[model samples]
Target: MLVNAIWDFDGTLYDSYPGMMKALAALVTANGGQIEPKTLYRQVKETSIKQFLTGFGQQVGRSVADLEADYHQRARAYLQDIHPYPEALAVLKAIKAQGGHNLLLTHRDRSAWEILAHDQADTLFLGGVDADLKLPRKPAPDAIQYLLRRFQLNPAVTAMIGDRSLDVDAGINADVKTIYFNVDGLNAAPQADYQVDHLIEIPPLFRK
Candidate 1:
């Protein structure tokens, strides 16, 4: 049977941490605050910008909205450098060649999608959900359900590939298979149907 996979944009398909870390450092410094690089990187990975900024603001006595606005303004230029992970495009091509369908399910906004579309013009993405859609984000199952209904995909044959537990939760909620892209085996979550350290490792799992 052909497989349908929903890929997470940030840590799974793209290596967005470098740019995000740079942006966070600049934003915090501009606000007369300081944050360790490692801590900021982890925070960005595990928490939403709004949640991180809300806590950061409470620490430095600034309004969350104001800080988020400033960070987003400063982060625009940083996003320009965002790039896909090595072999990500190749993996996508391999999957498609094997009669698989792919969709992007991310918490990113349209700006992020524009960046990705520019970087990889030929990638086969059925459609994507952005923050502007106002659908609940990852771990909420709303976006996955939308995709399943839109594509008429079988829940058992569809998969969600992501690097976080939220991704697994989303897949479970949507009644789809889940693949954990644990490059370092850092997050040992047992809920994942499969765990892989590299993008290319995915193809074999779908072989009939």
Candidate 2:
């Protein structure tokens, strides 16, 4: 049975991309640049917020820090609209019921806690690593390594569940099982150890 599950917060657990897209759109418009929403979505999903913001800043002759500041402020408004994915909470509950502990590891900053708290999902996590920690981002494995060491978790029976390649890479780097949550049919990371279409399908795999 899986004894420890590390979760990704944004697209993995919460439907946050729409809110994130809104924030990015507002930032681009404020900079007097027009963006194609689908293109922006694809770019962000394939790369990252930092990469996209940095590239956009360079294109529009703005500083990345300035754009990030404005974008984060805009994101706060939309964060309230973000919610847990259908059956996401149920999966977390199931993990806990199986005597496993659920933890969070996300690129989002402390604001991630806000969303979890809002949805009353914060209690499901034993702890987390967020951007506020100033740790290296996904694919680096620094954050996941820290979590494993700090929690005294064994990687063999632990799993990292996420919606992106970086998340799977982090898990691989940390020597843990990787579960790719490909609900969007994106098929982005076929290299993951396991892939699933729905959150409801998860708990059974770890059942004792």
The C-alpha TM-scores of every prediction are 0.88, 0.95
> What digit string (tens of lDDT, one per residue) describes model 2 on residues 106-168?
878888898788878899999999988989888888998999999999999889999888889
For model 1, the superposed segments whose C-alpha errors exceed 4 Å read none
What's the lDDT for all of these models? 0.80, 0.89
Q: For model 1, what is the alpha-carbon lDDT of residue 110? A: 84
Clashes of each: 0, 0
Model 1 clash pairs?
A: none
Relative to the true structure, candidate 1 has a C-alpha RMSD (angstroms) of 2.2
Candidate 2 clashing pairs? none
Per-residue accuracy of model 1 over 82-180 as CA lDDT, tens digit each: 788898888887788788887888777787668767877335777767777889867889999999998888898899999877888889898899999
Q: Which stretch of 10 consecutive residues in model 2 shows the poorest summed lDDT?
A: 199-208
